[model samples]
Target: MSEPVTLRVLGTSVTLLESIRQRAEEELGIRLVYEIHNVQQAQRIAVMQPERYDLYDQWFHNVDFVWPAGAIQPIDIRRIALWDEINDLPKRGRLHTSDKLGAGSLPSERLFVQHDGKLGSQPTERISMLPLTHNADSFAYRPERLPDTLAATEESWSWLINEGWCGHIALQSDAAIGALDAALALQAAGLARFENLGNLRLDEIDQLADLLIKKQHHGHFAAFWSDDQEAGRLMLDPAVSIQSLWSPTLMQLHRAGIQYRLAVPKEGYRAWFGGLSLSRRAEGRVKDAAYAYLNWWLSGWPGAVMARQGFYISNPPRARDYLSAAEWDYWYDGKPAREELPGSDGLPLIDSGERREGGSYAQRMGHISVWNSVMDEHNYLVRRWNDFLRARKAA
Candidate 1:
């Protein structure tokens, strides 16, 4: 018998690794070695020592910058026959265009084939990296607690962050710093920005930092969260009442019996995506095995499991087949997937299809208006954001 292909994965959660392991070993005829690491630790290992893992589970939103730094290689997707099966979204598809992608990033609706044998502008190149699942960000709040005036206008992103609701706001942790940019984009559209104070820009951060320093402020944040689990917890508990959150996590919380409402907000929620990538150091059969694993993930049973778990799949078509009509209704609306799925607070989640879309949420904070797409500015913004946080921490 051929030797089993041992695939080591870093920065994946135990649940996710277990799922992958079951699929890879049972289905792929390959041996799997999986390791779980937090995002920070994974980045540190990748930077400090390159060969720690063969495959790294990284978020796609930030993965593009790593390629230029030699941390990872563009995936050779052409080797995987199912490459054509995967769905490529706007920002994600543009990651390999030799052009930096950010807010206003264009979509590659058509498939480009490989060239003579490289991963670049040529259409026929191998795929650089494959993403697994992603979370969509949007505004969420407790419907019961919100004032009738605002709750009545829930269709818009503006109502949740309106001045009347600002004082009760909370933001996500710094890891979810992108939520800050989303807030800025909303403010640019003449909507009210949540005053988390933690996610402010370099100049704007000072005032926020000062307020936080004085108030010793702590509230549920409107920012994106670093820990996937916390999103559910925060939604269940009224820490800040209103903030940006991932769709799946919130849905999971609702299913677990929490009572909360999520909307795109008037300005729309900032969208971020996470996926899988290959370490540049991986070679030989391991790389080939990794490709196999990626392909397997895109097709077959695992993709279904992931979609049902509340995440958006990069392989949309395959994922759709996995979810039932009821699941679609639950995802599309706040309703329970079925009688078995309960809201986070132990009640049934709101099922009004009209309710989710009726508010000013889409008008004020929609995705198109909210993302800061200037790719060139990402470094500057990230650096300033980090520095501002540093100063805040020191103060």
Candidate 2:
């Protein structure tokens, strides 16, 4: 008997879950070896060691990092079974003409593999990555922890760095994302401004980093988390009244006790699109398995799982078939959940009559203010971010 083909899948906790692996292995009759890491570490491994993985499931922005290193090969849309079903959001970078089309590395900016062998937006037969699960992200807050004065006001990103919430806030620790979150807060507070919030220049990075370090010195931030689980536990800390959280973390908080309000910040969401890429080294049967996995994501079930966690799949209508009408209405249509909805654990996550915070899919996505990005000065930004992370107090 032949041994099962084993494909090494690398990604963060967001997509590389044990259940998904089990289901895929069962359904596809292939062995999957998953290597889950924090976003930064996963990208580093993907860029520096392409040989380590057959399938790279990560942020679309990561194509900027891996493509330059010749780490990942282009994906042929012809091989993707449902490529045409994928909405314009990823293919063109906006779902509607009115969509904000936020700054930074939008999927459309670098999705296609151009004639010059470069990642560009030009229509091409090949793409750098296969669009996967994506989401609009914002901070979560314990409404009970908020003082009535602030509670009565509109939700805004400023609360993350404002003096009133000082000593009781937390933020994600990824250099690119954390810096943007801080920049959003700083800009909201009227302390800093930028021409493009997504790609901060060196001066802007320094300004944001310095202000974050000073805030750290003053004990404005209670803690920082790099992973979804870490963010979950951080939110449980009494000191952390508000924190940037992903869908998984929000779900984690929901199951632990009360559901944290997924904030509809007046400033808009920090949006991100995740995708799957094939390692340059992948070939033959191994590459076949990789494509099978990518195609599987758009088939229905996997997308439904992601939708249940508050993410929007690349092909929404297919996932809609797998989800109940209640779920589609609650999640995509932005209508109130008509019935209780189960989470990954098959336990109630959403109660009846609870409207999604940002309204429908189009409404939420249209309001994106920025996308997770890798700026041209990424190295310097990373350095400053690390220095800020290591600072015990302001210099």
Candidate 3:
């Protein structure tokens, strides 16, 4: 028997990993091992040490950090079975719009490889990463606790920093994601404005950091979470009334019979795209196994499992085959679930007739206010973020 192919993937991918593990082994004859890490650790590992992992399944934001480090090799599109069926987000250059960052700053701008060993937007046989799961994120609040006065007003990201929610709010612990969340909240609250929210300037970083520190000093945050379990735990805390949230955690909370409303803020949702990449070290039979894994990821089964957890697959048409009509209508069409919907664990999480908070897939993705990103001043941003974390009151 051959050695198992080891994959370093994000912790959020647990369900997908479990869902596909047995089948992938049966179909490809390659045993798979997954090393799960938080977003920060996953980014660091993928960029600093390729030898430890054969494949990386993570957010595209990490491309800024990993690609230049030469830790990951470009994927050959010809190898991907559904390459043409992939979403137009990359080919149409929609990722580099003016409202978004410039070409150099856009992660998808250099998705294709050039002859100079550099990435470019031009069509090429090689791609930086095989785009996979994506989704829009927003904060959630306990509607019953929401003050009537504020409920009448427009829901906003500024609520994170609102004095009224002091000691009752939570935030993501990741610097990259937390910074974007804070930047949006700061702009909405009129505390500061960013020229390019994805890539913050030094002054913008400082301003946002200072505000976060001040909020911490006042005990504004009830908790800071790094994973779905942590997010779910924080949400269940009576002290927490609102916080940054992801779709999977929302489903988890619902399963536990906790009622929370995912906010459709006036400012819009924080969107993100991510996928699988082969490590620079992968070659020979291991490389073949890696490609097999990537193809299997887009082969419909994994995509359908991800859909149950609120993620959109890159090859939607392929994924459709594995999903039931009720699942498709509830998850993609934004229609109410006609029957009880099972979670990744096959246990019912959503009851019939419950509408998704942001509505349909198109409606949610179309309203993206910002994408998850690694700023040019990432070093300085990390320093400031660490400072805020150090100054925060212990929960």
Most accurate candidate by TM-score: 2
lDDT of 1 by residue, 187-255 (tens): 544543444322344444433334433322232123335555666666666555666565546556656
lDDT by residue (215-257, candidate 2, tens digit) is: 8897788888999999999998887888899988878777788
TM-score of 3: 0.93
All models, RMSD in angstroms: 6.5, 1.4, 2.7
In the range 239-314, model 3's lDDT, one tens digit per residue, is 9999998878977788778888888888888887778878899998788888888888888988888898888988
Positional deviation of 191 in candidate 1, in angstroms?
7.3
TM-score of each: 0.71, 0.97, 0.93
Candidate 3 or 1, higher TM-score? 3
Best candidate, lDDT-wise?
Answer: 2
Off by more than 4 A, model 1: 1-3, 12-17, 88-124, 154-163, 166-168, 175-224, 328-395
Candidate 2 accuracy as TM-score: 0.97
Residue 86 of model 2, lDDT score: 91
Model 2 residue runs over 4 Å out of place are none
- Between candidates 2 and 3, the one scoring higher on TM-score is 2
